[model samples]
Target: MKNLFFLGEIMSDISVEELAVILEEDDKWLTENYNKLIQQYPGQMVAINDGKVVAVGREVRDYCAARQKAGLVGPLLINVPHPDDLEPFLI
Candidate 1:
């Protein structure tokens, strides 16, 4: 029984497309680090943002969706200003 959690600042500036990208990337990263996360917590998927812990569940999809509803996307790099930053070097 895995539980998922997501945390972040919910503001009006967030975009759906940008959030989608973040979710996709996060999913990829999770898959890559699955072994480590599982070893530490066999049944928990916790999402953290700005040093705060949020939602917890067994399904990753559900966690991502909940975050989307809040308008925060991605486990993006701390320095990146927005999700589009992943597209090209912002001049």
Candidate 2:
């Protein structure tokens, strides 16, 4: 079922369920390779597709564009920040 999204919202071509599966794959990959990503891609953007690392770059748009240019669709893009790069909660 295609739900209506408001204008200006950046929507993916895939449905919510598909996105959830992709996110789950991303989470699994992160779980298995947390240390590697922090060391390799600290403060950078990375894209994962089909439970594999597809692209790595400094900017999200650039990498995603590169992936698109390579004909990849609906990749899960995430920022792998440095281990010490943390944000504290404030009221």
Candidate 3:
């Protein structure tokens, strides 16, 4: 079974299992490259497609625009926090 999802102005059909796997892989990629991303794009939003950075911007809307312009379909978008903004977890 497949479900219809919106990717910008286009709608595509994807299976639930496929979407879950894609989300999992995207999350893993983010975790694996977190430090590098922080160093390169501190306090910015980054759009990741297939484990690569496709767009970056300071504002959410700007990043969305950039992502759309780059023709990225259902890419993972996440904000990289500045090191200073992270609170230390003291046990």
Candidate 4:
């Protein structure tokens, strides 16, 4: 098995496909909870790991440091814009 670095985390003995699956799952989790999350963390950046909220703040840099300090690997980072600040978009 070889060591792989993903999102600043070293994943040992894991395949690329496995990593993809993990990321997909993360996306699904986020989508499912997006509405509730928007209300909870409006205008803030959120870090999620293992389907749970971990570190949160206004700056991505700060969240990165926080993730590193907490020894988190491949946590998903998302910025939740406040509803009032959202602009209409049409396609």
Q: What is the lDDT of residue 70 in candidate 4?
A: 96
Among residues 3 or more apart in sequence or in different chains, the pairs in candidate 3 whose N, CA or C atoms overlap within 3 Å are: none
What is candidate 3's lDDT per residue for 1-91, written digit by digit as tens? 0111224332166666876777688779988999899889998888777788888888768866987787766677777877776657423
Q: List the candidate 4 regions with Cα displacement exceeding 4 Å.
A: 1-14, 87-91
Candidate lDDT (C-alpha), each: 0.48, 0.67, 0.71, 0.75
- Which residue runs of candidate 2 sit more than 4 Å off their true CA positions? 1-13, 83-91
The candidate scoring highest on lDDT is: 4
Count of clashes in candidate 2: 0
What digit string (tens of lDDT, one per residue) describes model 4 on residues 50-73?
888888888878788888899876
What's the TM-score of every candidate structure?
A: 0.40, 0.68, 0.76, 0.77
What does candidate 2's lDDT look like per residue over 17-72, in tens digits?
Answer: 86667667767876798678778888877777677778888876777587768787
RMSD of each: 13.6, 6.9, 5.9, 6.3
lDDT of 1 by residue, 60-91 (tens): 66667766776554443211122343248545
Position 29, candidate 3: lDDT: 91
In angstroms, how far off is 89's CA in candidate 3? 3.8
Off by over 4 Å in 1: 1-12, 48-91
Models ranked on lDDT: 4, 3, 2, 1
